[model samples]
Target chain A: MDAIETNSLGRRFGDVNAVESLDLTVQKGEIYGFLGPNGAGKSTTINMLLGFTPPSSGSGTVLGYDLEHESVAIRQSVGVLPEDFGVYGRLTARKHVRFAIETKGADDDPDDLLGRVELADVADRTAGGFSTGMKQRLALAMALAGNPDLLILDEPSSGLDPNGAREMRAIIREENERGTTVFFSSHVMEQVEAICDRVGIMRDGRLIAEDAIDSLKDRFDADSRLVFTLDTVADDIVPALETMNGVTDINADGNDVSVVVADASRKAPVIEAVGASGVTIKDIRIDDSSLEDLFATLTTGERPTSRHAEENAANTTQLIREADQ
Target chain B: MSWVHVARKDFADALRSKLLWVLSALMILVVAGISAIPQLLYIPGQGPAPGFDDGMSFMFTWMTMMVSIIGLVVGYRAIVGERESGSIRFLLGLPNSRRDVVVGKVLGRATVVAVPTVIGFLVGAVVILALYDGFAVTDYIGLLVFALVIGLVYVSVAVAVSASVNTRAKAVGGVLGIYLIFDLLWWTVPMAIYWLLERELPGSTDLPAWYVLVERLGIWEPLGILSGTLVDIAGVETVSTADRLAGDVPFFLETWFAWVIVIAWVAIPLGIGYYRFNRAVMS
Candidate 1:
């Protein structure tokens, strides 16, 4: 069964449709990255799934339990690290996790959970005086209680430094390896791109794109920009490489040449042909299209709330394709 | 049963905040410290040399008042504070139902008020025994139970208010309004009504039964009425309800039925609170 499934799920706040006809599915044992710009309804969807907010329309299930009728059971099985969650300031960190374990009727040791989040030493310290990063870790430790089958984390790395965020990612990966289905929401593209097996992008309360990262990149017609430094430049280098396979575009300037290839598989052929052309290849640096750029393409209204950038990027790719023809 | 965990956690957290200690101190002052005032008033040669009855009558009045206020203070922030600080995410994020939250908070806050109350009465017993002569142990225990029941009543009302509203400001206003209208000024409610209908203020003798019944609906009125049943301290509220009635008293107005009113005071508010809380859409 899918870890989480929502069909035609929607929520409306007053006149605004906060989440409109959202059909989201996260398969078991996969890290599904929920991506959206701010106010894009990602959090709203999470709230509905967790029964924090009732949906205006449609139905859903988490781990075979109905979202509306069986919410308590859903929560019993799913571990949630909610966004904007606050800790009990007067209670110690270990107390927080132990409370969760008790509430869920789980047998996990509180100290072990604290150790996982690197909060073992501070377990006796009150959460009220903890730093933001420490509070986030404590919340994560609580979420790790009970060895839940599915973990729903909203912006899990939001308050952490880069190193802390990396630690969080490692823990999430470790949990997933333990046969746990991880569904986490984030606006940060790099972390999602690095860790998620598949991603579903939301925009204006609707799902616009859902695919594996490489496929999503490919769908945008993102050509890989390979920058190579040559020991010596051949006089006819540009003309000779122009007719090669999968070379979308090539720019030559002195001893540095950059080739935009249509796919990753074409990089090997282009490199072999370039070596045969009598130019010594000094270094190769490949830059695939980042998720930030893909998001800028998919949700072009992300900045300044306009759609012009999306059309421009599409037109640039079309121009390159026509030139190849 | 899961509410047990919620209650335990709430008590532990609030206990560590030192609020319980502060409450314990206040209760001691009200019960033990205030009970000694009657002894001080005794001039040694004038009047009945202020014995145990004097201390019991003097201290029970203050104990009731303090318990009511303390209960409200301890409970008003129980649920709303969590919502405001966003700790409710951890609360509801677990398998906890909203019923569990409301029920657990009431029990937890009730214990907060009860622990100190028990301590205060224990300490006050020693002081009352040493300072006075007619030390009736049953009367003192009766008053102690009365104080604890009053604490539960007010805590239920405060937690109900906390559950009904979404903000701390509203919770404060709710409890305050309830205190002033239904509790402190409850005497005026029936008096004003009697004047409006009967063209005069309600007198202490041969009064309308409806006026007394309206008074019984208040938070303190039923408790006050039941105090007669709970204890018979010599100098405290010696005039019984039957003495002031116009005719043969209705069965419901009897001292025993006041137990029904007290139970309603605790039950009805909690029922309403749980209903409102269960339907709340956590944002």
Candidate 2:
């Protein structure tokens, strides 16, 4: 069974359609990455899945339970770390973890959960004085309670240092290995690319693209560049390389020749073409288009004008006018 | 069961709050101070003297107001404050439903207010017993129960306001508005009604209907219900303020009915608030 499935699920805040026609599906035991820019409705979609916000249209199910009518059952089976959540400031880390355990009706040890998040030493200290990173860890520990079947994390790496983020990724990996389906939203491309099995990119409250990371790059026609340092630059090397299949943007800078290869399959042919030119190859370096670049290219492209966006803008303007009055 | 967890967490959190502690301490001090009034005035108090009853009655009157104020302070931020701070997400992220949150918050705040009220009453009872020989245990218990219920009523009011409003500032403003209307302006309501009726019907000298309306309106306010109940429970014929009104007390003004009114004050607002709260969007 799919861990989560939504059929054109949508939510509107007045005229602002925060999430629209969001048809998404995540398979069991897979780590699905939800990527989007700020205000792109990533959080809104997550909120709808968790039943924190009701959808204006469409239907969904989480772990075979209806999103609207059986939210409590879904919540019981799934763990969440919301994007904008805050801990009870006066409660200690131990108490927060214990509260989650009790709420989930789980047999997990609070101390063990805190230790997993590296919060064992300060478990007794009130969370009010905790740094943002510590609080994030505490929240993660709370989410880990009950050995949840599904974990939905919104910006889990937010407010974490590089080390802390690495630890968080490790925890996700461990949980995934334990057969927990993970759905997490993040603006951090490196973490998502490193961990996500499949990713869905959102733009203006719609799922713009959804596929495996490599396939997404391929679908966008983002090529990998191969740079070669040559012992000698033959006069015809540039033209010959350009004429080769799957090679484009061939350029020569003194002893270095650079060309964009459409995919890994084109790597061998491009190298063979260079050798055929009699230019002795010294060092070869291949640079693939990072997910970051692909993300920028995807989100920054000319967007289709949405009625919701226009209505939202009009509503905002009206609000401003009222405020001025 | 989930609500029990939520309530326990909220109770623990409230207990650690410096503001709650300060308010509770102040309430205890006020009760003790009020109980020591006769001693402060250097009056010899023993047996069933009028002075002893007067002091106890006076303490009950002010204690109701203080407990109501404390209840408002304890509950004004119960739900809306969490929503404003984004902490409600953490709460709802668990298995608990929105109903669990509302119920748990109300119960938690009620406990916070109830504990200090009990402490104040117990301390005041000890002082009253030590100073006056003929203090009735049943009357003291009655006063304690009445005071506690009054506290819960205001807590319900504050929680209702918190649940109904979206913003913390708005919730605080709403509760304060309730405080002003019920605590400060309640007395004026009856007088204002009388004045308007007198002006509207100038020829009618005996406005018995208006008097009955005022008495009924008085039942809605916690202090008024508390005073009337104290009068019945303590077996006092008539309070000084009411003695000048020159009329028999209405049936609704009886003490048993006052208990029902106080209980209704706790229930009606809570029902409306929770109804609205269940449908509220957490965002």
Best by lDDT: 1
Q: How far is candidate 1 from the true structure (C-alpha RMSD, Å)?
A: 6.0
lDDT of 2 by residue, A209-310 (tens): 778876655543445577889898545588777777876457678888777765568888988888877778899987654456556545544322432222
Model 2, position A322, has a per-residue lDDT of 37
Q: Give lDDT for model 2.
A: 0.77
Compose the digit string of candidate 2's lDDT tens values, residues B1-283: 7889878898999788886667667777777778677566664455434445666765765687788788888899999888888889888899988879888888898888888878877777777777766677777777777777777778888988888889989988888877777667776776667677676532223435445445445424535645554544343334432343346645665545556766776678788888888778765
- Chain B, per-candidate TM-score: 0.96, 0.82
Report the C-alpha displacement of residue B41, candidate 2, in angstroms.
Answer: 1.1
- Candidate 1's displacement at residue A191, Å, is 1.8
